[model samples]
Target: MKLKIINSDKILYEEDVFYLKAPGLNGYFQILENHTSFISILKKGNLKFKNKKKIKKNLNIEKGILKVNKNFIIILL
Candidate 1:
């Protein structure tokens, strides 16, 4: 799925990712290929995603919004 991370200034990251794990208000949650679409508020923590090559990455967000639709993930920080 296509994953894009952006803030007011610029696009932080954009790529196709196989898996994603984020810090939700309640706890940590994950997004996978073909997962259902939803939007949620994010807490300050580490945001993680694994690319097609299985390389893991971490993005730190202070607070943000997460939206998933039609296999596209958008994180607004």
Candidate 2:
């Protein structure tokens, strides 16, 4: 799936990921290929994802918003 992470300064990350895990307001949640669409508020925590190479990556983020739809995800911080 296509994933993009952006902040007020610049775009942090943009790539294709096999899986994504983010810090939801209540807890943590994950997204995978063709996942159902939804939007959620995020909390201060780590955002994780697995690249096409199956390598796991992590990004520390503050409060943000997450939107997912049609195999695409956008993270605004």
Best by TM-score: 1
- Cα lDDT tens digits, model 2, 1-77, are 99999999999999999999999989999998999999999999999999988889999988999999999999999
- Give the runs in model 1 whose Cα sits over 4 Å from its true position: none
> Candidate 2: worst 10 consecutive residues by lDDT?
53-62
TM-scores of all candidate predictions against the true structure: 0.97, 0.96
Q: Please, what is the whole-model Cα lDDT of each candidate in the order they appear?
A: 0.96, 0.96
**What does candidate 2 score on TM?**
0.96
Model 2, total clashes? 0
User: Can you write out model 1's per-residue Cα lDDT over 1-77, one digit (the tens) per residue?
Assistant: 99999999999999999989999999999999899989999999999999988899998889999999999999999
The TM-score of predicted model 1 comes to 0.97
Q: Each candidate: RMSD to true structure?
A: 0.6, 0.6
Alpha carbon RMSD to native, model 2: 0.6
